[model samples]
Target: MKPTLAPFPATRLRRTRRTPGLRDLVRETTLTPGDFIWPVFVRDGEGIEEPVASMPGVMRRSVDKVVEAAVEAHALGIPAICLFPYTDPSKRTEDCAEAWNPNNLSNTATRAIKAAVPDIAVMTDVALDPYSDTGHDGFIENGEIVNDRTVEALVKQAMSQAEAGADIIGPSDMMDGRIGAMRTALEQGGFRNVLLLSYAAKYASAFYGPFRDAVGASGALKGDKKTYQMDPANSDEAMRLIERDLSEGADMIMVKPGMPYLDICRRAKDMFGAPTFAYQVSGEYAMLAGAAQNGWIDGDRSMLESLMAFKRAGCDGVLTYFAPAAAKLLNG
Candidate 1:
């Protein structure tokens, strides 16, 4: 039943907005540390916290340092951490075999984090771009990024992450049939409890430039990923991808380049009523942080407001680089 509103003169909406406590009481959305999935970049080294020049205040950390960061995040009440590898150039290859190597930078970081911070969920990226010499998420054939062959490699990568104690497998490769394939492999390998968070509506957008640089793929990429990733123009296609991935056994779905695709996020959540998430990718972070650094906007307020926008847009959580800082502010 809907409540009937009083006459305009009798109603005073601003009364609720008159004070902090009143505004809190009337607030429809809330942001918290628990609503964040922190994205951490891993590199192969010791005692290294190399800064990503494109993304201010974000670093590519070594395995031991990643473990320390995971422990800190767990203490801050952040539920999960997502791992992205900054693969060494020597390891990048046409086959991308290093993507599934048990000793790979991502896997090593996953194992270390699990050992150190058992309570925090560990999520791993299932894509080949970090390890592919061609800088494609899938194998290239006749100058095209092929789908089926790429899924095979993704399955291997997912299985390796499961073996390394990753609690969530995030397949960001955007290849068809990967969700089902990875689900089958996980079940067969007795990793039935692991969750699959599919990057179902990832777009072929210009906003991923900073991420490519952070992962050291910018120089290696042969061409754009328009063939496999979704087009930014199609909203209906995003719904279709979400449906397909959920039907194939994804426990959750994500929309990438979050702020720009908020309508898609809201639609996905409204249509599927599932655990929906979005990635505030590197470029988005850069824009906000850069603006704030130049005294254009209040940084802390903007960060919290941006995260709250995700909740208002129907996201259950957001994969963000600002997780730690936002969490600290929320805690305070």
Candidate 2:
């Protein structure tokens, strides 16, 4: 039984809009530091804080610096920090053995952060692109990306991260059967408590240009990732992927390149009722920051508004470069 709406002026919709207190009281969505997952870039060397030119104000910090950042993020009430390694070309290999190395840059950073800030949740990216000479998320065979073989590699990567004290194993590699494989491996290895956050609807989009450059993969990438990643035009495909990952063993799921595919995020949340998140990827950050730097828009306002859109669209949290800034604003 739906209630009938009063006609015209009697409804008085503007009554709530007229006052800030009323607006705050009636707000449908809220943003906070706890709802943010800061994505940090890690590299080798000590005391290094190299700036990523493509993503202004974002730096590739060394392991020690990353630990410090984790401590600060914890103090700010941000629940998690995700690690993406900027692997050197010398470490890149055909088999991507370095990706599963327990002492690699990413794994080392994970250990350092966990040791320093025991209460902060550290998430690790489980993809071979950072260590692959071919710079594809999965293994390539005969100029084609193979599926099952890639899942085998990703499982090893996930297990290695779990060994390094990763609270969340984020498989950004969009390979089939990887989630089930990783889950079984974790259960057998006494890591049943570790969370698996699958990148279920990662799309092959032009927006990843800045990310490729940030991870130093632009030159190493042999070709596009269309075969493994989802097509940008298909929404039904995203739902299917989300369902498959959840059934396989994903504790949580995500949609990549968030703003453009918010429909996918909302759909995933509605259909699955699981913990749904979105990655506000590098290119999206660059666009807003670039415009703000040029005085074209109020950067702070735009940042909060953009993040709030994720909440309104049914996201549990957002992985954003704007985490620290937005968190500070929300705190203030």
Candidate 3:
């Protein structure tokens, strides 16, 4: 493609910007409900929807309330909903056995949503953070985060969610062989149709601070996730991880903490040409929300602009807490 000079005289960029209708006609990137995946936090209770302090408008809903939320999101035209849990402290364990419990917070929520709002796709986070007493995404042994053993547990966790009617199984643990292992188990267990949206390029970054708070993992976290999650300074390594996940049968790939990793999102999309998604993690939400709360930024305008950047960077969709707000604005 060669660059061409615009026709002169009437050749002003202002011509296209002359009116609201004209600007709408020339708009290049667009956002829609189909481009969103709503991530909601679930807690134990009934008729509950409690907001996270760090995330102004986001809530931790109970199972029954999660069903209601899913119905509302579907009516708003959102494509899917992802689940994260705020486990009871008593339920948390060093071995994270509750991670695969059929009646666990996430699994229970998944079953409720599938039964109540069967049309909305249900995506569950397949990591041990919320269940682990150590607040790590995987198993910890003798003060070290282990890999192979964690993958074994992750497989069981994935199967439980699948059996509970989850439409998509998202492996956010970043364990090397978990994707392939989960894929094989799902097939053997008669869930061959369940989608695997692997968190392929998740980075160990401070951006996840608010997320830790949302899931009640902040106080329990023993150490940083650097040993397992990718480093923020590497890009080539992200591509390698994305490639490996795809080869291992990942149906979709995600880059966490969306805005800071838009470059990685672009690279992953270009290199793999797969269904690439980005997580607009909680800290990013809190920063924007906090600034808006203090009159530092126009929250509404900035919110839409930030999400639009994801599409411009080649993300197929975004996992965001801003889904309902953005959907309402888009609908308007």
What TM-score, over all chains together, does every model reach?
0.97, 0.97, 0.95
lDDT (Cα, tens digit) per residue for candidate 2, span 74-137:
9999999999999999999999999999999888999999889998999999888999999999
lDDT of all predictions, in order shown?
A: 0.94, 0.93, 0.93
lDDT of 3 by residue, 1-332 (tens): 99686677545689889999999999988999889999999999899989898889888999888988999999999989999999998989988999999999999999999998899999999999999888999987788889999999999999999999999999999988999999999999999899999999999989888888988999999769999999899999999999999999999999997999999999988988999999999989999989999999999999999999999999999999889889989999
Off by over 4 Å in 2: 1-8
Give the C-alpha lDDT of model 2: 0.93
Tens digits of per-residue lDDT for model 1, 101-203: 9999998999889888899999999999999999999998888889999999999999999999999999999999999999999999999999999999999
> Model 1, which residues run further than 4 Å from truth?
1-10
| 10 residues in a row with least lDDT, candidate 3 | 3-12
Positional deviation of 246 in candidate 3, in angstroms? 0.3
Ten residues in sequence with the least summed lDDT for candidate 1? 5-14
**Candidate 3, TM-score vs. the true structure?**
0.95
The predicted structure with the larger lDDT, 1 or 2, is: 1
Itemize residue pairs with steric clashes in candidate 2: none
